[model samples]
Target: MRVMVALIATSATYLVMQVLRDEPEIALEMGGTYEDMLLQSTAHFSPLIPGHIWFRVPKTDARLRFIDTQYGFITPAARFFTVSFNDNVITNIRMSPQIEPLLLDDVLKVVLDLQDQWRANGWTVMYPRDNPPFADTPEWRAKLRDVNKGGITFWQAGDKYQVFLDMGRFRDSKRPNEERYLITLALAKPWLPTQVE
Candidate 1:
């Protein structure tokens, strides 16, 4: 009887693991892909293949925390869910389909001019191998190794919200140049006015 009970417990545990493995990381589109009026470009580290991403679960009530969402050691540019190894304040990085990369820098400069930009939002630039709690991690230092090569770097200075600039080996698949820009605005806070709310 004890042997049968043990076997049942083991089988239940295995089945539960399989089901949890399929849970979405970073919510539906927050991972990076964004949809806009003109164009619909996927965000960085998206289109992740199943079985590549994993979320840490502490208890039944704990929220799903995607691999990238939590700071840890991981590989760069992996096709897995956490492949991009992104660590930034603006978690999601979706852009409209009609957007163009030509004026990316120009637009970024203008947004940076905002004084309260960083206060309203936060962003930290990172490479594919970044290990963060912040931008000053070893992963960020690694980017300097090939400064000339260029890579994706997140920026919140551009606007009140965080933005990411693609300046690296590869460009976004949906967007043309690797110079694609990303902006992830936070949902309105409880106190913030909604157009005179």
Candidate 2:
């Protein structure tokens, strides 16, 4: 009975690892990608509704948050959803929530579900191995490495889409704890003109 239970446990762990290792397939399309859906939402809805659209932190205040000038809207600060645009083009989309402790399996499941949804909607999703660097400090790098080991997926559609799971230390004056877990699903189009740094 002990051996049988061990086998089952091992099998389940292996199955999850395999699922995480496999790359999501991609399909090419001219228009109507996830990017388009976000742009449409931003144009049609109001940011006042937390889920409908992401609010832009005006340029004056955005600099204070260390947000790039090109980015009109800041990444969701709490458990909220938002999409960002650059020159009328969809640039970023994010869904983030605060959790007590970051769970790798939970984060992976969320990213996979999002990938499946976009694929179902006729978007080509590619899980790329390379991710743009974001960490600077040794401590930050160590934390990021730990997260990456649990399996991080960087899904992209050409140069226009980027979907990934990431976490960071939240800095909000109202929130008591600045450190929180974040799961980000971001999209970007490199061709669009951006503000000079």
Candidate 3:
């Protein structure tokens, strides 16, 4: 039984590797519609963990529909993902190592690995001390303000992509007095829809 499970995992990994190798632009492209996003994610990820499915959550806001999943793995490897789309385009994606205890070092390692992936793909990854790479607009200012408050320690800017890594701890509302750490890697398209404002 153990051998069978290992075989399945290996076969799935190989299939995913083949897909990624065939599609160099597997990194979710900016401006892709929600359907496009879903198709791409399903095609790229469903093989990693059998039986896991991607689905949309009920719409809380008219402009955005939250799509979430617990797939087996992704580059830099994450299990949980929440994606937000507005006006048919993906506005945000948040990924985390959902198997928790959410240690600081573990989260940082994932963030760094993801940064390396972006760097390899031509993005200019930046640390917080560096000058912000985004255009200084009201929208960006507001966005950065939120990022700053959220503990953004790493970021990057590309022609169309903006990525940020946030790491912080907060008191868990459900378990009073207990601290919980959140490590989120977020991706957004630079020219986001005004509906997000």
User: In terms of TM-score, which candidate is strongest?
Assistant: 3
lDDT of 2: 0.39
RMSD of each: 20.3, 13.3, 12.1
lDDT of 2 by residue, 1-197 (tens): 99999999999999997854442211112233344443423222333333333334221111011122222222212234444544443345445532233443443344445556545543443433243223245553456446343234444443444446565433345554533335654445433232211
Q: What is the C-alpha RMSD, rounded to one decimal, of candidate 1?
A: 20.3
Per-residue C-alpha lDDT of model 3 across residues 78-156, encoded as one tens digit per residue: 4455555555554667665343534444544555565555555555645434423333356543443352343454443
User: Against the hidden reference, what TM-scores do the models get?
Assistant: 0.21, 0.35, 0.48
Clashing pairs in 3: none
Among these predictions, the greatest lDDT belongs to 3
- For residues 1-197, write the lDDT of model 1, one tens digit per residue: 99999999999999998855543223322343222200221122233223433322111111112122222111111112221212322233232111233244433442343212333433333232442122334553345234364334333322223434332222457765445433222221122221210
Taken over the whole model, the C-alpha lDDT of each candidate is 0.31, 0.39, 0.47
* Positional deviation of residue 139's Cα in model 1 after best superposition, in angstroms: 20
Q: Where is the poorest 10-residue window by lDDT in model 1?
A: 71-80
**What global local distance difference test value does model 3 have?**
0.47
Clashes of each: 11, 1, 0
